[model samples]
Target: MILTLTPNPSVDRTIAVATLTRGVVQRATDSRMDPGGKGINVSRALAVNGTDTVAVLPVGGPQGQVMEDLLRAIALPVETVRISQAIRANVGIVEPDGTTTKVNEQGPRMSADEVAALLAAVDRAAAQGLEWLIGCGSLPPGLDGSFYADLVRRGHAVGAKVAIDSSGAPMAAAVAAGPDLIKPNDEELEELVGRRLATLGDVVEACRTLIAGGVGCVVVSLGGKGAVLVTADQVAHARATITDPLSTVGAGDSLLAGYLHALTHGADPATALRTGVAFGSAAVCLPGTEVPTPADVAKIDVEVVDPVDLDLPL
Candidate 1:
């Protein structure tokens, strides 16, 4: 089974309008709400794709209850640690032209005890024999960036592969812990490497640097251009065939879910990259943060190719 941890969860409110005009009254054509968190998104995508997965997150206040109810309605397995602070709510304004503007909250503050309790839950989940442990999203306030690193260490000790999708100090610390896999988009990677990635060669080099830092593999997402997979043995680029534009949000999470699902199911890195690219493309073809179904992924053509010999800064 795949286990995902989301320290900061939220209730996502998506309002659809014809256009977003500042200082003007607007009416929303439609509205939808769902559980919103990186790991939560991954778990939902996995469950929808028929993967056995469970989401572990901290839930508090009325909004937290709403998040839990939404998860239950979808039949997704969730284990929430009750907290004192109310979970945050994110607002997304989607225009008719597919432009999405988002306003996000910083989420609730997590105390030491609450953070400990969440870690305990992760330990319990790991003890239950997890195939993949996904530590994703931002660290809640008052929690150290070493949180994901600790989870990676625990997951490795239990013989479960860990995949991390986070940014900033948490991501840097987790990389040093040597997670089995990391899925960072181009911008995040650039920040980690402290350099400008202007070309595919630059991205490949940055990925290799991360791999050299002890990460087993690195998947650098390149938006609509697809993603790059760098392993100890080879580097491969997977590109998605875009059909139509829908919503780009949560596409990266879908890609990570697909890749993790494939890796845990015994697919090679190349195959996993292809599947991830396809899944991400499918996600972009759907509205809002809704992940694509397996059938939708099957229709996208993902091309994988070997990169030419490139110079390395090492």
Candidate 2:
């Protein structure tokens, strides 16, 4: 089973409007809410395709209750650690033209005891034979960037492959622990490498730097242009044919879910790249933060090529 840890979870409320005008009243055409946080979203997406997964997070206050209710309705297995502060709520405004504007909260703070309890839960889950242990999203207020790094170490000790999708110092710390996989978009990778990757060569070079530093694999998401997967042995580029895009929220999480699912199921890296891109593209066509189903995966036309041109355009 795949296990995900989201230290800071949220209730994501999405509202649809014809147009978003500043300093004026607007009527909502429709609205929906879902469980938020990168790891949580990954688990939700995995459940969409009948993958066995569980989410571990801290829940508190009224909003946390709402989050639990939503997860229950979707039949997601979750392990919770109680916290004192109320979990945050995020708002998203989506226009008919597929424009999305978001307002996010910093989320609740976790005390030392609370953080330790959460890690212990991960340890217990890993002991139960978890194939993948994913540490995602940002570190909450009181926790240092070393939180994800600790997760990488703990997961590795239990023989569980660790995959991380986070930014800033937390990501840097996790990289130092040599995670099995990392999923970073172009912007996040650029920040990590401290360079301007204006070409595919530059991007691949940066990913290779990570591989050399002991990271087992690096997957770079290039938004609508598709994604590239890099390992010590091979490199592959994959793009999918998608039409009528909707909201782009949770697309990256879907990509990671698909990639990890394929890897755990014994698919080759190239095939995993194709499945990851297809899942991401299918996610972009759905409204709000919804993930793709099996039908969406079958409908995707994916193109994957190995030994990509080093000097190709970005």
User: What overall lDDT goes with each candidate model?
Assistant: 0.87, 0.89
Q: Residue-wise lDDT of candidate 2 within 148-244, one digit each (tens)? A: 8888998888888899999999999999999999999999999988889997779989999999998999999998779998899888999875667
CA deviation > 4 Å runs, candidate 2: none
Model 1 Cα lDDT, one tens digit per residue, 1-314: 99999988889888989889999999999888878889999999898998889899999999998998999899898778999999988888888666789898989998889988998888777676788999999887878989889989989888898999999999999999999899999999999899998887898878888888899999988886788888888888888767566667788999998887787788988888898898888888877788889898998988776554344221
Task: Name the runs in model 1 displaced over 4 angstroms.
Answer: 306-314
Backbone clash numbers for all candidates listed: 0, 0
Q: Report model 2's TM-score to 2 decimal places.
A: 0.97
Residue pairs whose backbone atoms clash in candidate 1? none
lDDT of 1: 0.87
